[model samples]
Target: MDSVDLQVLAAARRWAAEGRRFAWVTVARTWGSAPRPPGSWLALRDDGRVEGSVSGGCVEDDLIARMRGNRLGGGQPFILAYGVTQEEAVRYGLPCGGTLELVVEPSPDPAQLEDLAARLGQHQLTQRQVDIASGTVTIAAAERGDALSWDGGRLITVHGPRWRLLIIGAGQVSRYLAHMALALDYEIIVCDPRKEYGPGWDVPGTRLVTTLPDDTLFALEPDARLAVVALTHDPKLDDMVLMEALKLPAFYIGAIGSRLNNAKRRDRLARYFDLSEQELARLRGPVGLAIGSRTPPEIALAILAEMTAVKNGVAVPLRDAVAEP
Candidate 1:
């Protein structure tokens, strides 16, 4: 979930705790150009106040009007559709007659929402199921080991910390990578034991760790939402942490090197670390797409683009072997 969802949920909990009644609405489905995607949520107070948004403004306005007239109350959930016609679409600012579907559940059990918040605080992906007939909700643990599964009956809300990037070096390339990753809402940590690089390593919203790379990995205990990149090109600094990260469930593991250097590194890993072919294959040496990136920023962009693709479960195409003239 995003920050907006967190805020709305927190508000809902506060309202419920204060003995105020509110309804929770979720945009469960959309066709064409809905303002918000599925899983977008809104909380409506008893007096027609709302947090978050499902459409531009018209939908909220219409919902509020209904609420004031006492037509949308009681403790039951119902599905609503809007913008089925061009005029309605224009009125709601939906592009090209787009339609949106919402699930409105009144007086949601605050305890269940609070439980979800607690799980999210621990950085755990969770799935919440609401029985339409019984109006009961159940929360279950979710895994990032595989692609997200969308169940028609269950509202799967991913609850966790934002994605993270751990760069094992704090050089120029690391700075570029950190900047790009932050724009993508990733928490970044750059580690370097070298005092020269460590002294000037300051990036906003990025933590700088001057500890040894191996110890840093142990402390982090990286999970599937974390990606580790080794940009120092030093075996002493990079190899140990690479081994540690590979042992964990980090979604992307990569290192910067030439093809010849990568081959040598793999040989060393196989000889000393007992890494199998499959395990070694997980290490993307000569990291990033074959974009002919020669500068620090360009290379960083390529690496982050590749990481994003992997996180989204998309395949990276092999670059053409034919050299460009």
Candidate 2:
């Protein structure tokens, strides 16, 4: 789920806890040019209040008007489609006759909302299924590598931290990386056991863990949307975690070190941990795109850029593959 969906879910939970009635509108399908993507959510309160968005204000305005008029007060979950024509699409700000489909469920189940919110807060990917006809909800564990799908009478919505980053060190580079990652809506967790480096580790939207790196990786169980980078340059701190991260399904696993140091680390992993050639190949030794990153912030930028590219399944350019010496 994206930040918008998460925000809507959070607001829904708060409203439900306060004993307020509301509905959740989700943009599940779109054609041509839609303002919001699939999984985008809007929380509508009983008093015609809203927390999130599904379109470029026009659709929301219409929904709000309907809510105020009590037209949608009926406790029925149904699908809504708008902008079916070119003129209608243009009027609604959807370019080129785009059509958008929404699943509007009235008075969404409070328990289901809370359960999804709790799972998201715990950084676990969760699948929420809602039966339109029966108004029943089922929550299940989502497979890490699979995309969300909608089955007959059941809409599966994936909820969790959208992306995760586990920084193995709380140094200047880690600080820079954390800052950038937070802006990109990644849930960041920094691990550094050394007190000197761990102290004063304050970054908004990131969790700082002063636990052993290896233990942190074990606890995190890095997911497919997760990236782990070892920046401490300390074998005892970085190596063990890097080894563990390499074994996980994390999309990106890297270690910050010089070419020579990286070679040595690879040799050590192969010699001691019995890492196969394929596993070793997965480790981004030098870490980050080249981009002539000389300073900590610059290096962080390169690493984040590479991570973004990998997440989007884009091929990094050759220049970005190696840093300039």
Candidate 1 local lDDT, 1-325, one digit each (tens): 4667778888999999999889999887788977888888899988998999998899999889888888788887777888988898888777778898787888798888889888887777787666566666678887664323334454545566678889998998899999999878787889999988988988888999989998998788777788999999889998988877777888899888777777788898889888887788788777888888878998898889889889888987633221111
lDDT of 2 at 266: 91
User: TM-scores for all candidates?
Assistant: 0.77, 0.87
Cα displacement (angstroms), candidate 1, residue 150, comes to: 7.2
Runs in model 1 lying further than 4 Å from the true structure: 7-22, 30-37, 44-72, 83-99, 109-111, 143-156, 318-325
The RMSD of every model to the true structure, in order and in angstroms, is 4.2, 2.8
Quote model 2's TM-score: 0.87
Q: Tell me the lDDT of candidate 2.
A: 0.82
Candidate lDDT values, in order? 0.82, 0.82
